[model samples]
Target: MSLQEINFDGLVGPSHNYAGLSLGNIASASHKGDTSYPKAAALQGVAKMRGNLERLGVQGFLLPLPRPNHRLAERLAYDGTEAPALRAAPWSASSMWTANAATVSPAPDTKDGKCHLTPANLVTMLHRAQEWPDTKRMLEVVFGDRDHFAVHDIVPPTFGDEGAANHMRFCEGHGSAGVEVFVYGRPGGKFPARQHEQSSRLVARQHGLDPEKCVFIEQNPVAIDAGAFHNDVVSVANERVLFTHAEAFADQQGAYNAILAAFPDLEVVEVPSDAVSLEEAIRTYLFNAQLVTLPDGTMALIVPEECRESASVWAYCERMMAGNGPIKHVIPVDVRQSMANGGGPACLRLRVVCDPATVDPRFMLDEAKADLLEKTIAEHYPEQIDPDDLWTESLEKHVVAARQALLTALGIGELA
Candidate 1:
């Protein structure tokens, strides 16, 4: 195949902390005021990337966006007074969840035969809302080859878009034409629904996606209230297989029927709530996993270690594997830092299908680059960050230097 799906994971930032900035994210809320291990978190993320590179033969990583975004901090604290939420917003390392970076339409799915990407507005929350501008800039740098890629600005600020976390694609293979699905939410929920229907529709149109090949589905409000902030928290789709929970959509059967209407070959692996309750599923992040087609022609689910620790979730996996299902293997990884902050395996990545040759080499991974990154993180990253440390001058200097070291080591100081 000339084209392959590359997962671009975000390198966890040095400021990776538990500020409890994200609303509706239970893990983040529960872990507020806890000590954060920047060194271990960044190392774990690189190790995860290393695993994917070994399994898939290629991996890409996005650098951490500037932390304590002094610009945002200046604006929020211009009055010379400090509010806890406003104080923490500037220091959020939430960008590590690259799944929220952008929504991608591979070359095969677009009318122009070139990959198209639109950065998420992420207007729902303050910390995330500060992401799109920097995200768009980095996307343009890596995907700058105009003949092969088209990177669009985020949609108008009126609508909220949370990027690929709320999107899915289905096809015979990553290189073939595919049907895209956009999941949005309604107004009534205890927690604000992050993805809006208007934003999803605009992204589809901007990417030149065929209307007939796009399906829009409503997220289950109950799932949103239960802390499934993004649709990805409840469902994930590979080329032709969709492994999702029974209560994932507002109308689960109807949603499946809609997707099937567009692509008749779709395979559904539904985990009923009866077998594993929604609460247990969210806590373990059972569905927040990567379902990829392995080189050996079998499928594997790369799940969070928490999944293996949960009896119900692990038992369900065993039952699913015992059958002749499409998913053949289940690999569990440790990402406790990210997991505790409301992200699992899937949240740490953004999938873009294209020829590896078209991407900027600096962004792609090799054994040496991995070594350099780990070294920089080990030598420069802070060992631990306490909640009160967000206000310290020393922490600010250290966080900035840590990122600069990584950039210099990788010879991509332009990003710094």
Candidate 2:
């Protein structure tokens, strides 16, 4: 069966706040105490998804994970008392980035001819670790067609699987057999390695992927030290095209050689180190830009507004798009709220390749649905959320209520 790649973007949750809970993420730390606009952030994400559906015509939407996590509160034993550890749970909107939603093996690539999805344990960060159960539940409901879609349980926590954030696939087209690139990291720097090599291999084996088609590459320690916590921060791939920074991997040439060996038509678009340093790439999120194929059979680079704000990064993109290459245009999206919290256009989404008919209708969106979600956010979501507010009974009540209203509006029932 022919396939289309669907982008399942996580709607920013109601409890969105900046608490600097992500240890390795620079933006999260830099904007630690800043007040957040939960309503605005979610609307911004909704607008971006609407834009993708309008522009690309093949995108799907994923609802936000329930927040002000009651499970975490129960675990911490927050009996009307405040503790430093309790702060991370209520303010954790990190699940808004569903690229870490799950590691997906499309039906075309798996031996069983069933698309396999394993929700990430996300055990590296406390704030993110609590997301798997809820995420797994959502994935099961959305991709429940067991005949074609197989939703697997998360890998063991010790493995530290981070889902699609560190995984990339390459093939002639979405329907074709392809190479799965699993990028893992070892701890040798200030920033801890999030995705383990063992975790990547385990997921590959669980999905029954052909061993010959699976390639493992270690993330560059230098890149990790420079704050590229996830591979998506410095590299993104679609079809046979892999766009990456010069310093993205430990051995750039070897990674490219492996890709070339498996798929001869591989197009590696490397941003020269001279033009833009790794720091600039991470700051402007140049590599985090989504490299997607439009309906017209040509590719376009969907980048964050920060990329356009930077002279050097935008110029590089201009030059690259000017050429008669696979990438034909550049589109910038305003996800500054998400960017400020260490996510970008690419980070906000999970790419799943499958037949649209197989997905649950409630998980999909069009302009009409986007309008309803926007209306729901306007009605219930808080316009601003201060970190200090996370401690108040009123704020907690509001967050729970807001999420309940949203779920009711989306017809997904109570996920919280």
Candidate 3:
């Protein structure tokens, strides 16, 4: 079976705001208290998805989760019967970054002959910690096919599993036997190492993955200090290619050696420190860009608009595309709203490799469905969502109703 890698990007939610909820994320902190454009944010995400479909000829998309988590706020013992924080309920649109949605082990890599997914606990951040319950519910609905998809409960929060953000898959092909690299951070780093080594091991075991095919690598502490909050921020892999910075992991050579041992033909594209410093790479999110094999068998880099602005980053990309490398094309996209919150193109999606026929029908997308989604966003999503608006009683009602309308429009229905 040939597996097709589909990117399921999260649609930005209606309550999208910048409350500086994420602590380690530099952009999220710097832009805290700034007014956010929820309507434009959601539409921008939709537009990016459409661009991917047109340019890459691939279609797989996810719906925005319902927001203003009053239930979760109440569970956390917040006095929701009154105003302010009660009404705010954190207003997290962080769900827009679906990269942390789950850790997926494709059928080819699993023992049960079924794709397995374990939703992230998101325990490192308070706002994100509340997301799993709803996230699990959403995944269960989207990947409900028991024969092909297994959506498992998140690991214990104490271990701190951050999902696919700390995981990467490398193989001869998606359907072939592959190596699963799980990168974890230690407690000594300036920033908290979000994904625990124990958590990654547990997830691999739960997925019934072969231990021989699993390799655990510790993230570089220097990278963490420099604000590479997640491994994906500095490194990303697809099929046989691993594109990363020179200092992406603690043992860079070890990671490369292990991967090379597993997939001998692995093409390691390392951006030397001389070409682009780690700071610039993280700042411009050069590594966070999505590296995809286009339908024509040529590869394309889906980069953030910031890359176009950075001279060094743009120059490196130009040189790579000009060479006979797997990355043959470069396409920049505008995701400023998501960028302001410390997420880039890769951060905004979860890559699932499988046969489309094995997944749920409603989750699949095409150009026609993309247009319909855009129409739905314009019709129902909010145009702007000021931080102050979250305190109003009416905003909650509108946000809830809007999500229902979106699900109804997409035929995915309401999730728990």
Computed on alpha carbons, the lDDT of every model, listed in order, comes to 0.93, 0.88, 0.85
Question: Model 2: per-residue lDDT, tens digit, 1-416?
Answer: 55788999999988898888887889888998899999999999999998999887866777767667777888877775665546666568888899999999998889999999999999998889999998999898899898989888888888889999999999988888889999999987898999999999999999999999999999998998888899999999999899999999999999999878877889988898899989999988888878888878899889999989988998998998888777888899999899999999999999999988899888888878889999999999999988678858898788888888878887887464
lDDT of 1 by residue, 1-416 (tens): 38999999999999999988889999999998899999999999999999999998999999999988888988775443677778789888999999999999999989899999999999999999999888998999888889999999898988999999999999999999999999999877999999999999999999999999999999999999999999999999998999999999999999999999999999999999988899998999988999988899899999999999999999999998888999999999989999999999999999999999999999999988999899999999999999889868899999999999988887876677
Clashing pairs in 1: none
- The TM-score of predicted model 2 comes to 0.97
Worst 10 residues of 2 by lDDT: 82-91
The segments of candidate 3 whose C-alpha lies over 4 angstroms from its true place after superposition are 79-89, 414-416
User: After TM-score superposition, what is the CA distance of residue 220 in candidate 1 from its true location, in Å?
Assistant: 0.3
Between the candidate structures 1 and 2, which one is better when assessed by TM-score?
1
Q: State candidate 3's TM-score.
A: 0.95
Q: Is candidate 1 or candidate 2 better by lDDT?
A: 1
Q: Return the lDDT, model 1, position 211.
A: 100
User: Clashes in model 3: which pairs?
Assistant: none
Model 2 CA deviation exceeding 4 Å by range: 79-85, 414-416
